[model samples]
Target: MPKEKSLVKNVMYKSLLSLFNIVVPIIIGSYATKIIGKDGMGEVFYADTIYQYFLIFGAFGIYNYGLREISRIRDNKEKLKQLFSSLFILGVASNIIVLLAYAGFIFFNYKGTSSFSIFAIYLFSIFSNLFYVEWANEALEKYDFITIKTIIVKLIYIVALLTLVKTPEDYLIYAGLISVALFLNNIISFVFIVKDIGFTLKCLTFRRHVKYLIMALIMANGNVLYTQLDKLFLGSNLGKDTVAFYTTPQNVVYMINAFIMSVVYVTIPRLSNILAANDEKAYLKLLNKVAKSLSLFLFPAAMGLTVLAREIILLYAKPEFLPAVPVLQIFTIYMITLAFESILSNQVMYVKKREKVLICFIICCGLFNLIAKIGLTKAGLLTPVTAVMTTVMANIILISLEFFYSTRVLKVDIPIFKLDKFKYLFISLLFIPITYGVKMIFASTVMITLVTMILCGSVYFGILLVTKDEVVIAILNKFLKRA
Candidate 1:
């Protein structure tokens, strides 16, 4: 058996990746969007909305299938090589389609292209991503390399976008920067993947894997539905203004959700390897440990933001975006739900058949969300935020069922649903008073925000220490090397 790395290294690496992909990008991107007013910001988002839908279609589930399969058979170098070959060959067809789609978009304004001349940039982005997608660094837990690549990419992105994008009217510059940054990043990642893992072009083949490929495709296509289709529908139905308002919260929620999932993201490949080996004890222990650990980490971020929702909204966003703060707070509740589902969904792909379970789950949820958003919006019963809450609830129900199914398949006891059941009750009973007390001492806006963050985190950790939480004790002992 391959010796797995320790948990601390994995979590640190993934968190670093999250910082590169998220924290830097958002803070920098926010500056640009601020320079462009809400309406101008709205235009960039409109383009983003279009790009996201394309991303969904372009991806076609290859990344997930590739990761899980690679993890399951990491020790078998020959087999892994062939799997990559098959995947790479199949990816070529998808790449061509993506390129043609970009071409059509540029030539005919195929829905949301910036200008006719920037097709080269679009091609560069899609092609580079196609090559990069075949890498299984995420599955194999080489996040040391992943983090490095992410940092380099973000730098390239920030520099190119900021320098070249002189005006909102200069969308071509913006598009080119995005495309080039993605291409360069993916290229760097591709080089490492080839050198490290070896996607031996000759050994790879997918001709006989159509059944598996089709299953992966169904799941991949369905994923687009759960992730991005709503924005497209919103644009078509409610127009650009609604798209702007709806997407603002969605952007923040999605970024936060991605950050929240990084913990589980680091764990899943190991989860897969253990399941594949029939290591029941290891698998169950991993799942339970991961769920609880993530629950604790995510609780503070989610709850902290909800507490400071009004101030946070006013502090960061323009007035037009006030609509998104309450919307975002509602999503804070949904964040926990989405985190649970992401972790459990890994089990679905790992323990059971990923492609099948995901397909059924996303389709049902997507259709329900569409119906819910449409009906509620028409009836004047909800805003986009409220519609999101409805969708979030539906996701919770669906994934909860899948979690149980996977647990039953693995023959493990159900978790206490501790987060849903007692998390809020516990946080409220403990943290609210302390957080409020911190707010009073630091009256300045900047001072309060800074003090609040440090104090809230310190108090939360201290409370966990006092309560004798085993996880806290274990983490502390590991860090202090005093065990």
Candidate 2:
């Protein structure tokens, strides 16, 4: 048997990658917004949103499915090669189909328009997906490589962004640079993956994988609709500027959520392998740790963002985006919802092979979001604030359904809302008063934001240490031993 990589190292590297993902975007977005302004940024993001929808179809559920499948057979060299080739071929075929469809859509709807150029640039990303085999590396638990490569590429992308994009009209250049970054990331991964697995189409088989792939496709579409449809509606009904207002704050919340969830994500393969060996006790034990860790991190993150929404908006975006304050606050609720939803849906459902049930839950939530947005838009009440509130409600519904199904139907005991989890919430609530108190003394937005983060983090972890929270204590002990 192949030796298992250390989960601690994987988490550390994934967290570092997440930090770069978060910080680089903030840096690029802040600079880009200042130069491009709302409308410019809005148009680019709007196009990007549409591009994301098509990209989802292009992916056709390969990443999630491929990761799980590859993780299962990774120790078998021949089996791994066959699986990777089959999935890679499937991905390439799907991308080509989606790419053609995207071109047709652009030709029909956006042809001979100024927006055509922007959409055309995003088209390269679809082709880039042809080489997007990061799923295989992830299945092999290659976080160190993934992280280092991403940091290098992101640095190069940042340099290009700063040097090339100087004016509002340079949004096209911004779009192209994004595609180039994606292509570079994908192609590099592709070369490494081919070297590892070797390319072969001889043993490819598709029929047996079809059912699960379909389920994955449904889940992916439902998720995309649940997350992205609001932006589409906001852009169409209100304006692209409205999309910016909504997505800017959302981007911040998502960045934080991504960072928090990196810990959970790196565990997926292990969770799959644990379940595969019928190690029920080990699976539940690891899951409980994930739940506790998410609570420990997510509550503070949500609370801090809620309290510092205004300062963060001002710090990262133009003053006109102040309208996004409430949107940001609303998304704090989503930050929590999305994290637990991943536990329920991705880790539990996907690992347990309960994809059909998970798909139903997500599809229903997506429909709810669509209807609510349409209702709000028709009522002339669909501002960025209202749009995000609707999304949060939809997310709550999905999580509630998922929890009920996991516990009652599937009989999977997830320690989601235990007293220990709420302990984190109760402690994190201190951020509100503490942040406001600091705000009363600090005159500058930067000072308030910075001070609030520092004080809140120190106090939250300080209490955790005092109480000897198991998760915190274990982490600290590990670091101390390493030191």
lDDT of each: 0.67, 0.89
CA displacement after TM-score superposition, residue 43 of candidate 2 (Å): 0.6
> Candidate 1 lDDT, tens digit per residue, 110-227?
4354333444455666776677653477776788878887787788778767777676566566666777777777778777877776766675556666666666666656535443
Q: Report how far residue 191 has shifted in candidate 1, in Å.
A: 1.2
Instruction: Please report the candidate that would top TM-score against the real structure.
Output: 2
CA deviation > 4 Å runs, candidate 1 = 105-123, 170-172, 201-203, 220-223, 380-382, 407-410, 419-425, 428-444
Looking at model 1, how many pairs of residues clash? 3
The CA lDDT at 403 in model 1 is 68
Candidate 2 TM-score, C-alpha based = 0.98
List pairs with backbone clashes in candidate 1: 85-204, 86-205, 349-354
Best by lDDT: 2
lDDT of 2 at 196: 77
